[model samples]
Target: MTDFAVAIRVYYEDTDFSGVVYHARYLHFFERGRTEALRACGVRHCELLQRAEPLVFAVRKMTVEWLAPARIDDLIEVRTRFVETRGARFLLEQEIRREGRLLARADVEAACMNRDGRPRRLPADVAGRLAARVRDETSRARSTGD
Candidate 1:
């Protein structure tokens, strides 16, 4: 599905001794953004896991770049986008920004797996929904040249 943006406030727990958000905390922000994006597309992780062919998504690889430090009390936005979709894998591009300046960027590759942790094809309906969302986003972008 098309990626979505989620806004978050940096909190004390997310920071390090230097008073800046811990490096690992950015991953948590990205995770929440992805989860909320999926929910917006009507795909709930728990509900998907309850299906006959239960599936879970796991990050296969990730490349992250830190451009700036975010501190507690900062209002940040996590923007996530699904860049590619394959048989049982997807690539996502995510960025964390504050006041229009990028703070961090990540390229994440994720795979869908069954309970046994083996790769599995996403359900046809799920794939269709995701594809439609992507197409809609593309069309909108084209129209707005965004």
Candidate 2:
């Protein structure tokens, strides 16, 4: 599987009193996917923080759509991809799927920021690698509007 694929199992802690996954948990899965995607491309958050530029990725905005609910014990996959890149900001499209069923999707815009929280341009090498992995995929088996 590509770096975009991250498998996560919903646990008791991820659920609400109803035994259904708490809405906020989906965002956590997406975050992991984004982090792993960068790692697969040879970039790491700690390394970025240690660089001379000393930067971190901060979510500037996010729009999430809930299509279905995932319950505890469900095996889910969070798929992530770069949708666009503009200067210090990049847009990511992510989805939570349970056995090929789309449960939720989100569009996240993140910015590279310095320790002082000032916007900083993404490192050239990092940006290039991210762009190389950029993709927009619609379901072949079922379509969810992008």
Candidate 3:
């Protein structure tokens, strides 16, 4: 499957004392990719907030690897792939790449939650559509062996 990807420029503000991207900034980059991916797939966060349950997706767990550093002015691509979904949870695999080389990788587990902050199922129809899209992509990826 073709992973959802977003190009991000590492600016001066994204760097730390030594001029490399601050470690925590990578999380923001990953979030932006996921947000755009959902938008492209027809789920809008603003609309989600207007639902009866006023729902949102929240990251419950994540693991990240810092393989290399990104410096100011680096053009990084944040790529996201849906791994799976079960009940109120979803898993995404993401990577930060610079010039086709890996800078970092992360696996994130997200849970659907209501305004009250209690775990809840994602809107049924929305989840179904997203799941279908993910399945289609998975099939194509396997067929192409990419």
Cα distance off (Å), candidate 2, residue 76: 0.2
Q: Write the per-residue lDDT of candidate 1 for residues 10-94, one digit (tens) a residue.
A: 9999999988999999999989987887788787899889998889999899999999999999999998776767788877788
lDDT of 2 by residue, 1-146 (tens): 22278899999999999999999988889899999877987889999989987999999999999999999999999988776677999888888999999999988999999999999988899888877666323232134443
Clash number for candidate 3 = 1
Give the per-residue lDDT digits (tens) of candidate 3, residues 17-84.
88999999999999999898888788898999998779999999999999999999999999888878
Give lDDT per model, in order. 0.85, 0.85, 0.88
- TM-score of every candidate: 0.92, 0.89, 0.95
Model 1 lDDT, residue 104, Cα: 95
Error of 3 at 116 (Å): 1.0
Task: Tell me how far the alpha carbon of residue 106 in candidate 1 is from the true structure, in angstroms, after superposition.
Answer: 1.1
Task: Give the lDDT of residue 68 in candidate 2.
Answer: 97
- Number of the top lDDT candidate: 3
